[model samples]
Target: MTQPLAELDDVRARLDADLDEVTEPLAASALAEASDLAREYGRDWVDADRCPRLVRGLVARATARFVRNPDGYARSRSGDESVEWAEGAAGDGGVFYTEPEIRLIRSLAGRSDIHSVEVIAWGTRQTDRTGYIPVEDGKPFPYFADESEPW
Candidate 1:
């Protein structure tokens, strides 16, 4: 099932809150628009409870997967707290992806590019924490945090 058009407003609300936390005035509204789209289409693919978590997981997994580093340090020039947190949480053998990046994944739900296979690929990487996320592939996305990034 896909998310109803009404839920898009809620998604926008949440994204706005997140962006406000980061003081990113520009991306805040833009991401909120994307969030609206995510909330809309998410209904067609997953149930209500599953939709938000899926978005969070997809966003998390996307950051974890594509942003790998040989030294395990995701050198983000943006310096967003969310990105830094993911990096701080990772191990030397792991890669770090940002929360917003994962949020993008959440927004991708029910789209042609969004698929279980891609989500799995992102989630399967190992992390330092146990309950940071549900199991992905044979493992969970490694979640580590040295210090809380100031939002």
Candidate 2:
């Protein structure tokens, strides 16, 4: 079922507050505009409760586009603290992520509402997390067998 448009006001308001947390002046306004864009686009594709998430994704996507150093915006937040990478022992080459993994992390990190960023290894049976995002195959965003080996 679809949600009514009036409810978007509250979501947008919350998004405005979230956008305020952004330090860059230009990025702040850009993120606000991105939220509006998400609202317009999501009215047809997403429900009310999911609108905030969609807006957050929109902000992430938009921020990924305008920023000079994309890595700077990829800090994932947990409670009051921000974590740049998920806590885990180092993988192959002692590198935490590959090029594609870095892009995915940065993309997901753009959202201000996320509490943490966790990359579940592809074959793992775990499914307790609520916001699991699947990775697409190939080139720019290749899925790795583990953090160390690209598939």
Please give, for residues 1-151, the per-residue lDDT of candidate 2 as tens digits. 3333223233344343332344355455445544454444333334435444534544455543443333434455679886463234221112123344345434543533358778787657543334545556532343445655523
Please, what is the whole-model Cα lDDT of each candidate in the order they appear?
0.40, 0.42
Q: Per the 3 Å backbone cut-off, how many clashing residue pairs does candidate 2 have?
A: 0
Q: Estimate the overall C-alpha local distance difference test score of candidate 2.
A: 0.42
Candidates in order, TM-scores: namely: 0.22, 0.25
Candidate 1 structure, TM-score to reference: 0.22
- Top of the candidates by lDDT: 2
How far is 49's C-alpha from truth in model 2 (Å)? 6.6
- What C-alpha lDDT does candidate 1 achieve relative to the native structure? 0.40
> TM-score of model 2 relative to the true fold?
0.25
**RMSD per prediction, one decimal?**
22.5, 19.8
Best by TM-score: 2
